[model samples]
Target: MNIVVCMKQVPDTTEVKIDPVTGTLIREGIPSIINPDDKSGLEAALVLKERVGAKVTVLSMGPPQADLALREALAMGADEAVLLSDRAFGGADTWATSTTIAAALRKLGFDLIICGRQAIDGDTAQVGPQIAEHLSLPQVSYVSELELAGDSVVVKRTFEDGYQRIKVKLPCLLTTLKDMNSPRYMSVAGIFDAYKKDVQVWGLADIVVDEANIGLKGSPTRVKKSFTKGAKSAGKVYEVDPKEGARIIVEALKEKFVI
Candidate 1:
């Protein structure tokens, strides 16, 4: 089986701080990590590799620094890694990002493509489906479990209420949920091997991308503004008996039309 895993490097949102005065994200001291759900997709790919002797390739589109994320995927047993990085690819919304990835996949053919349900930084959950749209391939999003069965793969697709078991043929795409599988930690030997491996970096020249849809020029959505919700200051503090508290809560609910 030939599998391609899409991965991303994102700032650790937990460590992300916002400036009070500037009302902007403080990225200076933030550390970057592989987007968690994307790692789950990699883990799923690795499992597929073990099950059917598949060769796994990792692909990511980001700045040149994103090569680090690809190398890390290599350390996790991916056969090859490709980084799509170019100035033209900068400031891309998910539409542009998925377009670039779809182009890259055309250059690197695959029997299956796996991606995360969503990136942590942008929880829009649009890129995977967008890639499927761009590639004109069938896709199953939010797959929690899967198994290989002859020529087709059976997937347990997840939903808010429950999950459905469906079989999809090869040349299909899947967006994996966090519970898809357990991601393995890189071994000492694997970590050392990653440094010795070479990750292929591709620019705009390497992939067949529509110039109008490659970057910010093609993105229709842009954050007009980003600001953290300011914390509410101290509210009214009333010392009262349990019965009085209950009455106050009921009145407050009625006032807010939440009753």
Candidate 2:
């Protein structure tokens, strides 16, 4: 089986900062790492690879710095890696992003495609399902467990209160959560080999992408404005007897219909 895993290079959340002037995330100087849930997705693919002799390919789209994430994937045992980078691919919304990725997948081919449930920075959780739509393939989201069943695959998906088991045929997409599996560590040899391995870089010219279906022009969504929420105001402090304070609280609650 051949598996395709979509990974992303995201700013480390803990160190992420907001630019006061632009009201946007300040990615400059922030360390970038593989999205956590995407790591989970990668782990799932790697597990299948070890068990069933599957070949895993890691795909990511970002600036040139994203090559680091691809290298990490290679160290984690992915058979191949591809980085889609170009100025034309910048400022892409989920729709355009997924479209570009789907185009790449069309070129590479796949028996199964796995992606993280959501990206931390975007938190849209739309790309995986959108890619499925673009590829015209069946999709299962929030998958926490998976197992091979002959020609088909079985998955356990998370829901509101619990999870349900689902069986789907090959050539399907699954968006995995962090509960899927633990990511493996990179070994010394793996790290060295990662540098030796070739990572294919593609741009608009490399893929058969329609000019109207990539980057900002193809994206209908626009960011009108972005800003951080103001800090909460301090509550009123009453200097009165305990009983009087209780009475005031009750009266305020009643006025607000909290009673």
Candidate 3:
């Protein structure tokens, strides 16, 4: 089996800051890490590789800093890593990002594509399905359990109500949740090896991507405005007897028209 895992480098949630002036994420000088849920997806790919003796390749799309995430994957047992970076890819929304990744996947040709259910920062939960649509591949999202049976893939997918088991053919896309697996830590030797390993970097031109359908110009949605979520302090707390506390709660509710 030839498996591909899509990973992302995201800003540390606590360190992330939004530029009030440009209405964009301020990434300069900020710490970056692999999206947490993507670690589970990478683990799933590694497990699959071990079970089926497959070649696992990790792919990521981001700025040059994203090479760090790829190197980390290499240390975690991925056979190879590919970095897709270009200035033209900046400010792309989920649609454009998915399109770019799908095109890259087409170039690589894979039997399966694994990705996190959603990125930590964005949490849009749209890219995986969007890539599936772009590739015209069968897709299952929020997968918790996965198994390979002959040429088919069986997956347990989580929905609002509960989980549903489904089977899909090869060349499918699965977006995995954190509950899927526990990611293994990289060994000291693996870390040292990854330090000397070279990650393949590809640009839009290298992938032979159409300029019109990728990056900022190819995106239909534009960021008309961007702003950081306002900080909110905790509300008041009351100290009183049970009866007094009930009265206070009622009064506050009435004041807010909640009663």
Enumerate clash totals for all models, in the order shown: 0, 0, 0
Lowest-sum lDDT 10-residue window in model 1: 223-232
TM-score, each model?
0.94, 0.91, 0.87
Candidate order by TM-score, decreasing, is 1, 2, 3
Tell me the spans in candidate 2 whose CA falls farther than 4 Å from its real position.
19-24, 237-259
Best-matching candidate per TM-score: 1
Question: What C-alpha lDDT do the candidate models reach, one value each?
Answer: 0.91, 0.93, 0.89
Residue-level lDDT for 48 in candidate 3: 84
C-alpha displacement of 231 in model 1, angstroms? 2.7
Better structure of 1 and 2 per lDDT: 2
On residues 34-121, what C-alpha lDDT tens digit does candidate 2 reach at each position? 9998999999999999898999999999999899999999998999999999999999999999999999999999999999999888
Q: Please list the residue runs of candidate 1 whose C-alpha ends up more than 4 Å from where it truly belongs after superposition.
A: 250-259
lDDT of 3 by residue, 6-84 (tens): 9899888888777867667777988888887788999998998888889988999998979999998999999888998
lDDT of 1 at 119: 87
For residue 246, give model 3's deviation from the true position in Å.
4.1
- Give the runs in model 3 whose Cα sits over 4 Å from its true position: 15-30, 233-259
Scored by lDDT, the top model is 2
